[model samples]
Target chain A: MENIILTSSPTTPYFPEVSFDIDKGICEIRGESYMEETYKFYLPLINWIKDYIKLIKKPLVLDIKLIYLNTSSTKCVLDILEILKDYEDDSGQVKVNWYYDKSDPDMIDEVEDFEAESGIKIELKEF
Target chain B: MTSKTILSYKGPFYIELISVFGTNIRNFNDTYSNARKKLFKIFIELSQNVSNYSENFHMVNNVQRIGVGELFLKELDTAYCFTTINQVKRTDAEILAERCEIVNASDQMKLRELKREQRLNSPGEKFGARIGLIQAVMLSKNQLEYKVENINENFSYFSLTVKIDKY
Candidate 1:
């Protein structure tokens, strides 16, 4: 499987930093995301994960370190998590880690909500 | 309302305008970082609802369609009130009004459960009732108030208000 590396830029203001390394099986999304054109930006990332899961047959690790994300962006993140959960359900190796500031209990609660909703075990790393 | 106007905008709810609003808001309310962040988040979530789903639209360069709406902020002695008004289909207005009732009626824990069910049951569709309203109420720590006024038979003017209590 070929590796995909996307460099993060600030072209559209608070959009997240996305880096998807297929070879290392690590996909990280960081920074703030509040874009209204949510689907246009996230659909590709979702598809990339879907394709990687189908073809790579390797353990995938997903890391999310968002300072803040609008509700639309939250839905998009769930979409990605749903994909990972499906893959894991099929006996494929997958791990999801969500990093948040310890000061923000809301972020922690948000992660727990995601875990409960998706039935996916997400390791929480607090700073 | 004895509160003074912090900011008010009435026009198209284009994407770029959201950034402009955030910048102006940060400039004016820089001292209160926590409250300002909450306000900014609530503002983005609520205003983007108007941008994405507002039935009112206008053409730009005779090519693109843009959503139109009104957003206002007022600083009270103990809290800040945010309001957004836009045009929506009568059907959408009805659904939104009902949703607001459900949201406002529920306590915090119930609202959190509702948000969970909402996110879990949400279809993979690009747009629908997602976490926006839930986040708005959560951040504001107040009930959401919505009003729908008749604007012909198919469309109505929908207004939503959220209040963020100062800590």
Candidate 2:
């Protein structure tokens, strides 16, 4: 599978900066997410994750470094997590790391919520 | 006097309010990058509350809605106060009052925990109803204050204010 790379923009919508390297099996989603059309932006990313789970059986590492994300974006993030959780359930090795500013307690709780909802163990890293 | 005359007299006041609000937004450049993004999100959520759930008349065109309300952002010595005023039905006013009371009564840590629980339980499609107030309070990292002004006995005007610390 090919790698997916997209830069985050403020003017248009909340499309997070994404880099999914098929060879390395490292996917990083960072930056702020508050898009007007959330589903449209996130559908491709979800599809890509599903494709990766099917085609590539390598150990996957998903890193989240989002600073600010709206409620709509949060649902899409959950969707991505559910995909990862399914892959993990099927014997695929998966690790999810959520990096947040140490000062921001709200973000920490948000990450924890994602972990609880998806039933995925997300490693919280303070930065 | 005629209705047209009355509207014409009120036109300049409306123009002045818009100009002032625009100027406030324009002059807001303290820490434009991150703070601006946060401000935009907060404003969108708060204003949309007035549009979607408020009993007041809100203009809807396509998927976008605009509500008649006043938003003020004032910079103090150490923080900024963001205030919004709009009309709401009595039931909405009661709900908002209860939510604001709960938010104001809780500490930061408690609020964070509450938000986490709510986020996990919230169904994906429904937005702007449950989490908006909580999100606004959390985003500002400050307490929320709300007041209800009785507009007759059936409806009321709700005012909410959130303060953001400058860091």
Number of backbone collisions per candidate, in order?
0, 0
Per-residue alpha-carbon lDDT of model 2 for B19-58, expressed as tens digits?
2333345345656444544555566556545544555553
Structural similarity to truth (TM-score) of each candidate: 0.90, 0.69
lDDT of 1 by residue, A1-127 (tens): 4555555564566678888888889999888888756777888889889989888879999999997888777788888888899999999999999999875667887898788877899999975
Model 1 ranges with Cα > 4 A deviation: A1-4, A8-11, B23-30, B60-64
The list of candidate 2 runs beyond 4 A from truth reads A1-10, A19-26, A54-58, A99-106, A116-119, A124-127, B1-61, B66-68, B126-129, B139-141, B150-155
lDDT of 2 at B74: 65
| Model 2 backbone overlap count | 0
**Judged by DockQ cut-offs, is candidate 1 incorrect, acceptable, medium or high?**
medium
